[model samples]
Target chain A: MYKLIWHMAWNALGRRRGRSLLVTLMIGASLWGLLFMEGIYDGMTEQMIDNTVKSDSGNLSLFAQGYRLDPSLDRLLPDSLLNQQILRTNPLIKSRSIRFSHTGLLATAHAARQVQIQGVPLEEEIVHAGLSDKLAQGRLHFGSDGNGAILGHGLAGKLRVSIGQKIILSAQDRQQNINSLVLKVNGIIRSGNQPIDDKILYMDIEQCREFLGVSQGFSQLSLILHNPDNTALLQEQLLRELDDSAIEILRWDQLYPALLQGRQVMKTFNLICNLLVFCVAGLGVWGVMTVSVLERLREFGIMIAVGTSFQQIRAQVLLESTLLGLGGFILGAGSGVATLLWFVEHGLNLEVFQEGLQAFGMDTIIYAIIRPDYFTTALIAILLACTASVILPLRRLKQARPVTILNSQ
Target chain B: MDAFIEIAHLHKTFETSREVSTPALIDVSLTIPHGDFAVISGPSGSGKTTLLNLLGALDSPSKGTISLGQTMISKLKEAELSPIRRDRIGFVFQTHNLIPVLSARQNICYVMRLQGRSQQEQESRVAELAGKLDIEQLLDKHPDQLSGGQQQRVAVARAVASRPQLLLADEPTASLDSTNAERLLDLLEQLNHDEGVTVLISSHDSLVINRARHSIVLRDGRVVADHYERNDIP
Candidate 1:
C-alpha cells in the first residue's frame, strides 16, 4: 500500500515537473533565511558568554554579601584561614584568585580619566584570567616588588599613556581616607568589549592594596569552576562550608542579570523572525499545494473512480507534499549552515554603528556564532511549517467527490 | 438461473442547486439473469448513466434495494463494496476510460491485482484476454497512443480480465465512429456469447441496441419499454 502511494505521488509530481521545482525552490529559500537568522543569534549568545567568562568573570565568584550592588572598600571580604580551608575542599574548583575591583581616578601626561581598577596577584591573574596572553603591547611583567600595572588600549589612549609611562591612581580607603600611588604601565590589553577596554586597568594586588590604604585585606575572591552549570551546586557546598557571617558566594550569571535578560530577549526576537520567515514559506507551500491539487483534480477523480478510496487519495497527496518539504528542508538547512560559517569566519564590520555600540557598551564587530543545536531547531521548525501548510489541501482532497471532479474536467 | 442482479423501486434525485431538485431516476427496477446480454437505450438526460452507476454499486438509490449475487449492495459500506466491485463487477465508460499512466497490459492486469490474484494467474489471464481482444500488438502502448477502436478493445479486455460475473458499460461506443462502434459492439457481443459473461450496456446508439438480445428503454427516470428479441437483429 505504501509503495502504491509512493508510485502515485511520484507520477503526480512527474506530471507537473516545472511547477514542482518552482515550489521546492521557494520553500528552500525561505527555510534558509529563517535558519540563518536563528543560527547567528544562537552563535552570538554563546560567544558572549564564552568571552565574558574567559576574560574576567569565572564561572562563579565569591564576594562579601551586597558587594555586587555596592563595591565599596568597606565591603571587602575579610581574608581568613577558614576561607582558605573551604577553597581547598572543593575538587571542582579549577582555579581561584582574589580580585579587588573598584572605581579610581588615573592621571597621565595628556589627560585624566575614571577607570575600573582590578587588583589581582600577578601569578594567579596570569594563570586564571589569561591576562598575560591578552597583552597587545609591552609584555606583561610583575616586577620584583610587584607595583606595575596594565592598562587597556582604549584607556591608555584616553590618558595618553604608553608603556613605561608613570600613571597616578587615587581612591578612598576603607577608613575614609584618600590614598594615591604612582605606577609604571607595564602592558596594554584589548578584550574586544568596548566598555571593558575603555575603563579597565589591571595591577598587582599589593599595588592595589597600597593605593587603597588597605594593607591587610582584599575585596573579593573569584573562583573559576570546571563547569558553569554547576554554579548552584557549588554555591550550596560553599554555604555549608563557610560561616555566613564572613563572606558571600555569587554566580557570575546572577551578577549580570540584565545581560542574561538581554540575551534572552534577543533570542526571542530571533525566534519571532524565524516564525515570520516560516509563515511566508508556509504561504508559498499553500500556494503550490493548492495549484497542484487544482491541476490534478481530474487525475484524482479518475483514481477515485477506478477504486482508490478517499483515504488513499488523501494519503498520496500528503506523501507528495511531505517529500517536497523534506527535500527543501535538507537543502535549506545546508545552505544556512554554510552561510553561518562564512559569516563566523569573517565577522561583519559594524564600524558605522560604532557610536551606537559605544552607547550600549558593545563592540563594533559582530560575529555569527554557529551551533549544531541551532541547525537542528531550524530543521524541525521548517518541517513543522511544511506539514502545517499541507492541511488545507489534504482536507480538500478528502471531501471532494469523484463525480463532481470528473464532471468538472 | 438465479437473478445475478436485482433492483426494486430504485429512486435517484439530484439536488442541482439550493432550491432545485431534479429527478434522475424514479421507481426503476431491473433484473439481469446470468449470461444475459442486455442493452438500456434512451435519449439524452434519460437517466441511463445514473441507472448504470446504481447497478455498478458505485452509488446508492435514495430508496431501494439492490442485490448482487447473494449480497444486498445498498446495505454495504463503501469499503465492503470495493471488494465486490473488484471480484464480481467490471465497468467500461464512453471514453475508453483507461488509466492514461499505465500500458494496455497494465490496465488489464490492474483489476486482477486488486483481487489479490497470484502473479502467475494475473499474467496468464492478462495475456489470454489481450490475445482474445486482439490488443496484443498494442499491449505495451499507453491508452493515449491507441486509436479509439483499439482503446475500447483494451477497455473491454480490462473489464473481463478478472472473469467478473457482471460487466456494466456506459455508452462504450458513443465516442467512436460507425465502423469503430461496430467493431467494439462485435467484441462485446462475442464476449457475451462465447465466454458466457453477463453484460449490461447503456447506450442510445441504435447500432448497439440492435445487437443486444434484450433491450430496456427509459424515459424521465422510468422504464418505458422492456423487450427481448427472438433473433439476432444486427
Candidate 2:
C-alpha cells in the first residue's frame, strides 16, 4: 500500500518538474552554505585553542599558589615540590616542561621592548610541545654555549632584530638587585597565539637562572597529558591527594576562559544559523505543497469520494514533501562533504588577511573540521522541517469536501 | 423489488454567507431498487446532483435520512461514512477525475489496492475490465494522454473495480460527444446487467434518460416524477 502511495506521490511531483526542482535547489544551496560556515568557523576556533594549548599552557599547568598573582623571583615553586613522584612517574603526565619566567626589558641596538622572558630546556620543550615545528626562521638550536635566545616574531619585528643579532635582557634577581645578560638570537617562532607571540622571549633555563641569580627552583611546571580529556580528572585527583597546599593545578580552560567562551559563542551562532536556514527552506516547501494541494482539489475530492481515505491522501502529500527534502539534503551533504574534504587537505589560505587574522591570534590558512554530527543533525532537521511543513496543507485538504469539489465543476 | 437505497424527505441547503442560504434539495424522497439502472433527470439547478451526492454519501442531507442497504448513513460522521463509500458505493464524476499522475491501469486498480486485494486479483480485474470497456490499448497511458471518452471509461472501470454494491455517476456523459456518450451508456448497462450492480446516474442527456430502467425527474428542488420503465430483473 505504501509503495503504491509513494509511486503516486512521485508521479505527482514529476508533473510539476520546474516548481519541484526550484524548491529542491533552494534547500540545497542554503544547506551547503550552512555546512560550509559551520565547518570553517569550528575549524578556526579549534585551531586557536590548539595553539594556546601547545605553545604556552599545556593540558594542565602547576604553579606556586602566589606566583601567578605576584610573578616575583621570591615566589618560585621549590625544588622538592618539583621533584614529587607523581609529577615524574604518573602515566597521565605525557610530558612536562620546566620553565623560569620573568618580566624584563629586551634591548637591541636599534630598539627595545618590555617582554616576558621564559627560560626553558630546549630539548624538553620540543618533546613536550613540538616547539621545533613552530619555528618561523633560523634553527631550533640555541648554540652550544647555551647563551642563544629564541625570540617571538612579533617581539623580533618590534625590536628590529634578526637571527645572529645580539640582545640584552635585564631583570631583577632573587636578591632584589638588577642583573643583565647578553644572548644571540638563534631562532624565531610564530605560534599563532597573539599574547605569547607579541610578548615572549625564550632562552636557556640554566643561563636564565644564573642571570637572575636564582637556583634550584622554577616558576611553572606545564604538564601535557597522554589523554587531554583526563585533565579535569587528574586535576581533581591531584587536588585531593597531594600533600602540598602551596601548589595550584589549573586546566587550560581555566587559564584561558576567553578561548573557551569563543568556542561556545561560535557553537551558539552555528545553531542559530542552522535554525534560520532550515526555517526558510521549510517555508519554501510549504509554499509549494500548499499550492500543489490547492490546484488538485478536484482530483483529491474524486479520490475521497471513491474510497481513498483522508489518511492515505495525507500520507501521499507527506511523502511528496519528504522526497523533495531528501533530494535536497543528499545534494547539499554530498557537496558539503566534498568541499570540506578539499579544504581540509589544501587549507583555505586567506593570506590577504594575514595581519587581521594574526590580530585575533589565528593562522592565515584555516583547515575545515568535518564532524559526523553535522550531517546527522542536518538530516534530522530537514526531516522535521519537511514533516512540519505539511501540517497546514493537510488540514486544508481534509476540510475540502468531495461533494463541494465535484459540484463546483 | 428490494430497495438498495432508501431516502426519506431529504433536504440540503448551502449557506452562501452569514445572511443568506440557498436550497439545493428539498423534501426529496426516492427508492432505488437492487440491480436497477436508474437516472435522475432534471434541468440545471433542479437538485439532481445534490440528491445523487446525498445517496453516494459524499454529502449529508440537511434534514432527512439515507439508508443504503441496512445502514442509516445520513447521520454517520465523515470518518464512519468512508468505509460505506469505499466498500458499498462508488462515484464517477462529471469529469474523468482520473488521478492525473497514474496510468489508466493503475487508476483502475486504485480502489482494489486500497481494499487490500492481492496483486493477482488486481491484475486479473484490470485485464477483465480493460477487455470489457475496450480500454485495453489505453491502459498504459496517463489521463492526460487519453481522450475525454477514453478517460471516462477508465474512470468507470476504477469506480466498479472494487465491486461496490452501488455505483453513482454525476453527469458522466455531459462532457462527451454523442458517439462516446452512447458507448459509455452501453458499458453502464452491460455492467448493471452482468454484475447485478445497481447503477444510479444524474444527467439531463435525452439518450441517458431514455435508456434508464427507472427515471426520477426533479424541478425546483422537489421530485416531480418517479417512473419505472422495466421492473422485472433478468
Q: Write the per-residue lDDT of candidate 2 for residues B100-191, one digit (tens) a residue.
A: 87899999998888888999999999998888778999999999999888898899899989988899998988777888788888888888
- Which residue runs of candidate 1 sit more than 4 Å off their true CA positions? A78-86, A132-138, A142-147, A160-165, A341-355, A358-376, B76-80, B100-125, B134-147, B177-183, B186-196, B230-234
Each candidate's fnat: 0.06, 0.78
- Weakest 10 consecutive residues of candidate 2 chain A by summed lDDT: A400-409
lDDT scores of the candidates, listed in order? 0.77, 0.88
Candidate 1 residue pairs in backbone clash: A43-A369
Report the C-alpha lDDT of model 2 over A282-393, residue by residue, as the tens digit.
8998889888888888788878888788888899999999999999999899899999999889889989998999999998899899999889989888989999888997
Highest lDDT against the true fold, candidate: 2
* RMSD of candidate 1 to true structure, Å: 3.3
Assess each model's interface with DockQ, reporting 2 decimals per model.
Answer: 0.36, 0.77
Q: Provide the global lDDT of candidate 2 against the true structure.
A: 0.88
- Residue A22 of model 1: what lDDT? 75
Residue A54 of model 1, lDDT score? 51
